[model samples]
Target: MPSEAKSWRWRYRFDGKEKMMSLGEYPKVGLKEARDRLAEARKLWSGGIDPLAERKAVVEAKEAEEREQQRRAESSFELIARDWWARWKEGKSRRHADTVMSRLEADVFARYGHRTRHLRTSSVKLNGS
Candidate 1:
């Protein structure tokens, strides 16, 4: 991202034709959003599409996907928990599975004396049994 002459330029090229596209002036866009936009534009070019128009479409589509994911995250806690439990059940003993279920029900949500969710899902609910 280049700021020059009171306008912001996102520089790029394709087919040996170098160019700088105006991405509006500063205070109108942030550096992170601009970089993300550039990445999507390049992805479209690699897939054989025009970059400029595809950049707009990609932003809109990406926003929609993000919104949808946020909505699902807000609405589907139980479903997500069940999905997690199903996966956890895949490689653990019955005793371990029981310990995990107990922890979840107890809201401990962690391995014994551990606070992170990075524990092995298999036998996550470990039991001496």
Candidate 2:
């Protein structure tokens, strides 16, 4: 059998419908803090804003930011170049592909592999240009 857990929650009506929102867990959120949270939610409701919707929007924005950071990390120059090589090597001679990859590792990747795909050309300073 699982032990029961205690949590603080607030129940209120919005848009002619009943809704409940979790404030926090017991012990972690004391009585005073729970009441404070309830008051904040009520204040928002009185101001014609749905506290639940506002909280959901904030959570979604944070999630979106996290996903964007992950995307940028996955799109580094070395990763993109390796992905391209996998497709470009098909039907090509092993020696030719190996030579191409060796040159890229020793030259391009050494200098700019850590950069993300969103980098602009002007941001990179060429040796000759």
**What root-mean-square deviation over C-alphas does model 1 reach?**
12.3
Give the winner by TM-score. 2
Can you give the lDDT of residue 15 in candidate 1?
Answer: 67
Q: Per-residue lDDT for 118 in model 2?
A: 85
Per-prediction count of colliding residue pairs? Answer: 2, 0
In candidate 2, what are the lDDT values of residues 7-80, reduced to their tens digit? 99888899999999999999999999999999998899999999999999999999999998888879999999
Give the runs in model 2 whose Cα sits over 4 Å from its true position: 78-114, 122-129
Error of 1 at 53 (Å): 5.4
Q: Write the per-residue lDDT of candidate 1 for residues 17-121, one digit (tens) a residue.
A: 776776666567777777776777678778877687666687999999999777665445454565688898988898988787777767633323322333355
Return the lDDT, model 2, position 51: 95
The candidate that achieves the highest lDDT relative to the unseen native structure: 2
Q: What is the TM-score of each candidate against the true structure?
A: 0.33, 0.65
Evaluated against the true structure, the overall lDDT of model 2 is 0.91
